[model samples]
Target: MNWDDMRFLLAVAQAGSLKAAARSLGVDKTTVSRRLRALEAALGRQVVEVRGQGLNLTDFGRRLHRHAEVMRDEMQAVDALAGADTGGALGTVRLTAVPMVINQILVPALDDLRATAPGLRLELIAEARDLSLLRGEADIALRLARPTEGGQSVLARKLGDLDYAAYAVHGAAGEMPWIGYETRMSYLPQAAAIARSAAAEGATDISVNDAETLYRLVCAGHGKTLLPRIVGAAEPRLVELPYRHGALPKRELWLMLRRELRELERVRLVAQWIERTLAVRTSQAQPTRPPDHRDNGADP
Candidate 1:
């Protein structure tokens, strides 16, 4: 197989389509397609298969993809070393996390990052879905729970714990309706708890996927929902519900990154900035006690 064709394979594997690969490689679609065909002919095996508008890797292609990633990382390491000699971390670091963490936490503290590493550029992706680190979709990811994927090629570390609390409109009286995550998010303990409470009360639950939307609906006096204390503390109009803090749901914040990128000066700088920022934020929101506290009506 032509070593040069490996770049085409790696590009398509990461982008999931030939057109995207062509765009990344600064070539036309025909060039990418021809290169892929030549690669397949050389190996006498297919690397990728068409699936609707996208392409999926074959078993043989997947093996090649892994090798391609190692090559990419090694090249990046060399570039990083060369760049490091210039005296400051330079280049972009893509970070992914849920919207609440992005909007409520990190976005507010971006000035700190600029001051620490003015040459560093951060691309923040705010979504619930995990982007592939090995595929170079994101350089670092913040997860609410421990990540199950990535094996040895990824590094996982605990940043801090996020405490949850029930929030509703200030001075609001009576049992407000329950606002919660959609059914698809029931894996979240707080979401499941809200589902149970709403179901038992026979109250029609309002469901939303994003934390910012959920917080807005709750603040509008439409319903009560669980929010990370760090998020809830920002709004004075949204008051914490009567539920005991100890009984509320809490989740650990985890940082994940590709092991290959760990040594890059820019990647390491951004990772440390994230760690420091979250540590300060979590400490500000940590609850004082762990004793018995009863939920008045909002269980979560």
Candidate 2:
């Protein structure tokens, strides 16, 4: 008998009723009934019997069910193999990363990524919180720190380091108001670092939850705030403060993926692109000398 007929038999055997089987299979009950009859006719034996209140599989039907399950598994394996072979590096890969990295770093490299793998599509989930890779919420992740809870099944690599520098609007100088992360965000390493640095410099008059918001306020001449060097360097209106006393702490950036997904061509390609992009960006980020305070309209 054909696999389609065997599928109906397996469904009916598992569901115990033609109506339930049809519902599960997305077909009419009559269709399932007909298929089962056709399969029995071809096999020349009764595979099922009507019990007191439900359908029961006969001895032969139970044996056939075992074989059908094996066939179904093989079919699934074949489908997966065929899809992978035909769609090499062509499907959408979901990536989750913090907003700053997406906007300041990854977005700049999109053109190169497209050129390298035109068939690959990207779905970016920009949020600070780590998305679940094991649950398939994301195919890849760029995290500031190695994830603590995704288990050993996750594969992570240290892509590069992100350096932070205190920035302010051009000409804004000494003892200026500082912007910092709110207490709610103090749990983050970057926030803690900013808090310590700001404490020694000036009073924090503004507190925000995200780096992008802090960046905007600093650029608007609101207050000096610590930001990733890459972001601060891109803003012409902003100038980096001298960290002569002590350099801001550097955080390591990580590229992570589920171990199972590493085999996919698209996943591997995207991971390589991310690693390369971050490395290049990090290398190109030159340390800028603290702007001459005298030029700006600030008290000497």
Top model number, TM-score: 1
Residues 100-191 of candidate 1 have per-residue lDDT tens digits of 88988899889988898878878999987777675567879999999885666689998877888777776552457678888888988888
Q: In angstroms, give how far residue 157 of model 1 lies from its true place.
A: 0.9
TM-scores of the candidates are 0.73, 0.67
lDDT by residue for model 2 (1-300), tens: 767798888778767998888976789999998998999999999999999889989999999988886665456435434546364557778899988888878898999899988788889899977776644567789988866634455788887678888778876645567788899988776687777777776656679888878877887878887788877877778778765436576778888887666777887789989988876776776786775554684552
RMSD of each: 5.3, 11.6
Candidate 1 pairs with clashing backbones: none
Residue 292 lDDT (model 1): 25
Off by over 4 Å in 1: 2-40, 44-66, 75-89, 202-205, 244-247, 288-300
TM accuracy, model 1: 0.73
TM-score, cand. 2? 0.67
